[model samples]
Target: MSTFSRLGGLLLAAALPLGAQAELPAERIEPSIHAELAAHTRHFAQQIYRVAGNVHSAVGWQLGNVVMIEAPEGLIIVDTGESVSESRKIMAEFRKLSDKPVKAVVYTHFHPDHINGVQAFVSREQVERGEVHIYAHETLLQNVVAQGALVGPILGVRSAYSFGSFLPASDQEGMNAGIGPLAKAEPSSFIAPTVTFGERLDTRIAGLDVQFLHVPSEAPDEIILYLPDNRVLISAEVDQGPTLPNIHTLRGTRFRDPVQWVESLDKLRAYRAEHMVPLHGRPVSGQDKVEEVLRMTRDGIAYIHDQTVRWMNKGLTPDELVEKVKLPPHLAGYTPYLREYYGTVKHSVRQIYNGYLGWFQGDPVALDPTPPRQQAERLIALAGGREKLLLEAGNAYLKGDYQWAAELAGYAIRVDHDDKLAREIKARSFRKLGYASMNINWRNWYLMSAMELEGKLDGDAIRQRSVEMREVFLSPDMVRSFTPQSFLQNWVTRIDPQKAGDLELTLGFSFPDVDEQWALEVRRGVAQLHKGIPEGTELRLSMDKRFMETLLTGEGGLVKGALLGDVKVEGNLLEIRRFLACFDFADEAFGLTLR
Candidate 1:
């Protein structure tokens, strides 16, 4: 049997006890979770699903989905899938229907899944040569780079947990991300936007009239594409299939304003689209159905946001707010599209409370609390010592109270790091919790955490994987485009002060290909770049722009590049080596839930 077939059979067996309900509550995963997961695995087949004449959806195994429009001149591609590997398959599928070249590529947003697969649609050379035009929101170029430079490493690790990026793909294990199956990371590529516009851009591409509206929902750089003649709306992440929109992703990001999101939905609802195709999931057909879904989605978000604020005015704490907020029977009855497959109402309430009211709950105890570990130590003693806590935890586990058991075990282990018995109990509790989780991200994180506790996953491996993922999305041009002040801030913070110590050196860089010359000074672990050469320089490296990019990305060693004449180094070799040693390589295996 094929892998997918074998997995499907396993899912069938696992979900035998599950009833008609598609998902269980977040506290526990039951048999039905497997059925739902299996459904997600087969959600979008490798073939095209035509929504209208000349408009088709190609669903990739990866999270992102692409829409293709067959115009008279050629083809127009909207929102490429997650990775280069997935994009290649998506492109091949498009070719099966039409052999025309991609005339234009439109970005739905600056999210990695939406825009990372650009090279698959058209080569970078084609973009530079004016053969293919890439369009995106004007803020896309800036936001993409800024997000990467600021929180790239931290977010990458969280994403691994949220998307099951590090877990093995199998029915018994990671299964799939909530939206779609996981895609390979290595085959990812990024190309800068060729053309950018603000709120609206109406133009003709491939002999087809197109309208792009910057929606600013999931990402500030988001846009919704409308093909008027076809009456199809590519609604980006605004309406992601049969799942509730992730207004606040557990994988950290800036708060998505609920008010703005509702407004974006309002604008999209005005289109009266005959078919509404979202970037992440299956498309909606019929004008009335599209409007209905958009309305429910809008109202659902507003309900969560407005109610959370209402209760906040009543002096309710975040935890109390979570329990208090719930969709009305009418809206809650709307299944599939408005259900909590990806985002839940409880989390949304917490996000709303924090986003609007800040972290303080007006509780002085929470304002300045003891560190968890220190508190755990006291808690363990108050519970009659580690042995007493373990006894209680064991009883809780026996009673199937996995959440409480895990909490007790956590306290015991934190109080004594060498508590192997406590760790084992906690790991088992995590496994049970993972199995019971309805949220796919929660499931993945719980399962991964269990494995991590058992020493099955290495932090170093996670670190390496995250670094590679970051490298795939970031490019030298993206870095260069940042204002010098922004660029310097990112660069200087990367230096390891302990490594540099008292060493002070100036390095001059001459990029002959770009005709840009700059001087970099590293003193007391502080690094800064200036436009012209500094008065006192210890060493100089002259290289083509390409070589500089490679150096910054850590693709090639400085000594190797210098030896190969890729970088021409002058002055003291010792100073160059010392300068290179000052910057610390990122710690990829940084803890998530484990530590």
Candidate 2:
């Protein structure tokens, strides 16, 4: 018996117990998880769902839905999709319901899918003039900035794999984005939030009574919106679509406290509301349906957390826990919401183990398993050299032992990274594993990694897409809160030790609009940033903070600003240019999957 069984014709395979769902027939007539994943595409067709008389949700428009709520004074938009182009189409459809101008935009959180498409609903000029107000949790700006400034490049690669962003847009290569139709890199814009709050904010928008609760869940700034007058509850990521909520995404995320997420679910349940609209899934009406979904979603998370802790107390390692923890038949076999579409018991158990105990498992040998490549080299030598290893991997693949084949191929690659045959064996093994995977994140990661291994994914194609992501992810609206201090601090890390080893110089920066002065002094091999331009500075550049911010993200308006005298340059031009060239730079040309 397998963990779950999907005979021919059934859509979901979670009808069986974990023990039963683990094994398929020795000869698989049809792959179960693959069929189920293909069937899951039905939920992602572009459609508009009317949750209530006044509230409608546009799912499949982008990674997340754009929900529109009609109010007495005007239309209040909640969650404005991911791309400007798609949101424009959604906004056009929303206009058919009512021609009311968008008065207020509520950002449930700072995910690109939630906040990136703000320009389609309201113009930056309108927001500046106070005609349209955007609302969000106060921490939204900081999180957004960190994603762009601190970790955007690495995240871009990881997200590309997890979202299958580079895969061909077809049923064979790419099907659905688990939660949505596809992952696209489109022109996106941002607007700074005008209204920010902590804990909770109770206010009236467009003549409708609304309350925003700041609960940390998927994102630290996640907030749920409640409409008292209409008895409607807008769940941001709390009710994360119709799948097992990704307590932790494979693309990498901060620790999503399962306890906090469960508590957030409880907070949503407290609102005994009649209607519910999720930013990811279809809206629900009737108190009973809402409660049922809420209860099941809550219990699914609680089950993973509690069960993992139960075994974790017995001194089990993460390796052991991934195999040990499984959803009880009730949660895994029956309900649609708890099915392993995006999140899985295997991944969540490891996260729980790490969350509670961190990287170490109280074993010194495990603590310093450093030099993993050397370790693989030694293991391969012990297994009779690279030739024998390749032979075993090929045999394993032929015998339908894909896991063993994949592991053996991994060792072969580590020993000889450029081995074409070794890479081919591993790529084939990964494709088979991907077909057997039910969680879309795991499936996509497998498929994309296989693509990278097979030389199918082009680096040139990836560079432009990653650059676009970096641009919007760290746009000016996100960096509005950054001060001269933040930008100066970044310069410390950007300094190049090899290039500036014997070169010494001082550069001063003045943001006239902000009335701030800063200086970076490079001494031999190190750089130091100070406030109020250091006395020995040889070069000083003055510009408005806005132009400076734009330059920081590489958006390119510096030439125009300099020619117009908006940016003033002082000191030796030749020396300044040489010194500036010493700093490190980043681009998407880095390896897509290989180290």
Candidate 3:
């Protein structure tokens, strides 16, 4: 039998119990508590109740629940659902309860799910009229603007895998599994916040004493609003039940401060609210329960932080720490809440260590690394022929030893991508690992990698659309960091920096409804990125941000397109050409280089 057939049969044999397959009521929320809340508030037009998300069972991406707090002023909405569509559905349900206008909207963070559906609640004109005040942290505007163009699109594509958006909706696949329902796509629209505050802001809206706390941990732009009168706390993404917080997201981004994250948790612990509502997942009530959950969460982060640092001090490698680290029994018991649905402990610990100590773990050998493919080929040659490796890999697969199978097959495929048998074995091994992972992010990563090997990668539409690079205003540090990744030294050598002597170039980049300008100075082979207009210099280049991204990625070229006027260059055109020449196209053939 084929490997797929055998794997399919094994999965079929492990099917869930008959009770698991039976679908619950269409509109019924799970864990029963939420359903009871919905039932209790069914008849009351202006009643407040907590809706449960997938809290007790699953983790990550599953929103908690929305607070239905109706007042004589109007229906004051806290957080919309996870997506624009989900938010629309939630608003529809709210309309069923009352015909009141959504007086105001408040977002906990800039995560797509939380703030993507403002149009559903109120029109732009209503918000403009000061009738509806969309409130968030002052930094929320910066976060939204930062992610508006390229970053947003890139994240949206990766999110498909992170959230299992394309997975088959089977009980064994995409069912609630505790984190709420999974779907392929969500209709979303970005709405900029109309009002923002720096620190703590208290105001009365819709008969509620809404106190906004600028909690800069989970997200620097996140705000946790407390309705003191109702004793309800709206925590954006900061306090997510008991799960290990994603200090550094795997799909990629800046290193989140673990210390700050813990401090923020401590702040929430002191709130003393009777009820807590999170952006995703279910609500937690009762003071003791809230404290217990908060403690578990705080301790979980502390455990990873303390243990990882302890190991780091002991000269332990990242790999060594991953194997040795374990949460205590008290923390471990919160498995339902502490599952690696988003961030795995192993990865989280690594990030914590990196954030504090930097990458080098006191090992000189780790200072610079050789490419993986080159090393893999050498290892394969040392292990005899490829066929021998394949045979051993097959044995491992049959024994259900996926880790060994993956390791062997990875080496085999790296040695030769045309090796069909090795690729097949690697793909199946990854699927098995994905199937066994409770951490949804890990599952998605493994599965996505496997799909690439099998040539079944999805979500290409978003990937194909090049984002306007200029729309994202990167800080000088951010731009410097991106230089090594975006442009290689070899490409840099191609450009004659000597020809572009102390040239100052200004480019006014604008997107539809978005505007920003970059002032660049090229001198002595260094390019400095700055904001605002440039001073006197050699040239000025004007183009849309999308076109700039395409040019940088080699999908389009500056000199070739400049003639067509797709890119316009004024002043010293030759100097601009010299600057372009300084960048070398990245060597795609150099597989497994330090990323």
Between candidates 1 and 3, the one scoring higher on lDDT is 1
- Estimate TM-scores for all models: 0.85, 0.88, 0.75
Best by TM-score: 2
- By lDDT, the best candidate is 2
Query: Residue 406 in candidate 2 has what lDDT?
Result: 80
**Candidate lDDT values, in order:** 0.75, 0.79, 0.58
* C-alpha RMSD between model 2 and the true structure: 7.4
lDDT score, candidate 1, position 216: 82
lDDT of 3: 0.58
On the 0 to 100 scale, the lDDT of residue 159 in model 1 is 71
lDDT string for model 3 (294-353, tens) is 778878887888888888889888889988888877776675556555566889878877
List, residue by residue over 243-299, the lDDT tens digit for candidate 1: 777889987888899999999999999999999988777788999999999999999
Looking at model 2, report the run of 10 residues with the lowest lDDT sum. Answer: 6-15
Per-candidate clash tally: 4, 9, 15
